[model samples]
Target: MPDPMKVIETHWNSTPVPIDAIIRDIGLPLSYEPMADNISGYIERTDGSYRIVVNSLHPETRQRFTAAHELGHYIYHRDLLGDGVGDNRAYRTEGTNRPNANIRPIHERQANSFAANVLMPRHRLTDVTDESTAALAVRFNVSQQAMAIRLGRAG
Candidate 1:
């Protein structure tokens, strides 16, 4: 598979970052559905094709994050994935809440990091000065919390 970061770099021409295009460019099909409240999304390989499903009920911005996160899994954890990964409300898989692993699985952590990078790329954020998180989130079409997390990570 092509490097996820490379894919992002290739397709990331805007804030909110053409997420669906990036996912599709990586060769995965995308869909949205209403899911249980705590369920954000999941990625599964059925038959021969890979697919990413996001909760339609979630906010659109959040869904973009979720999709990017699943893309992260497709990139970093394909071998470890036995079937698929279901992310919970906090964007973590079940049984990944162990504090020792920083309260999330390494895969989950990596995916989350990847999602942040996809949405609010470090190169973009580094060019800004004195912008508020809320403003940046709006510009990036991501949640304030997510933007704050990305900013923190960038620093």
Candidate 2:
């Protein structure tokens, strides 16, 4: 099995790891668009470009995770084969909410794991335990929920 921290670190240093840069790197146009209720974000493959459409409806934390999750799809899941051969699985668009949806069991888990690691890489999260979720949320420009999730996973 691969070390999750190592995988996140590798991606962080080598590519456009910053959020905006990652958005551009994936050929998505940077824009501030309002998202409807219950909609966190959406990913579209259009004109040979992958666009991540974020719904500014919820708190910032939700948007951050949504972006990272979409990026997870872009990075890890898109290239895998779908024949149940090797480690591949079918793609589902029901969203990555494990409690609500019944998408491909493994892929959703992988994407969530990827999102958690990418959004709050482990090294940076080491000292985060000293801070409250709100403090860490402010520091990361994400939500309290996201901060809690990251903290839980990192620890």
TM-score of each: 0.86, 0.65
Measured by lDDT, the strongest candidate is 1
> Where is model 1 poorest over a 10-residue stretch in terms of lDDT?
95-104
- Deviation in Å, model 2, residue 19 alpha carbon: 1.2
Top-TM-score candidate index: 1
RMSD of 1: 4.1
Total clashing pairs for each candidate? 0, 2
lDDT tens string, model 2, 1-155?
Answer: 24433445555753224665555654556454574464555555556545566666666666666667666655665554221111111124443222223235576577677776777666777765567878766766766666677677434
lDDT over C-alpha atoms for residue 51 of model 2: 59
lDDT scores of the candidates, listed in order: 0.80, 0.56
Scanning candidate 2 in windows of ten residues, the lowest lDDT window is 81-90
- Give residue 25's lDDT in candidate 1 (0 to 100): 80
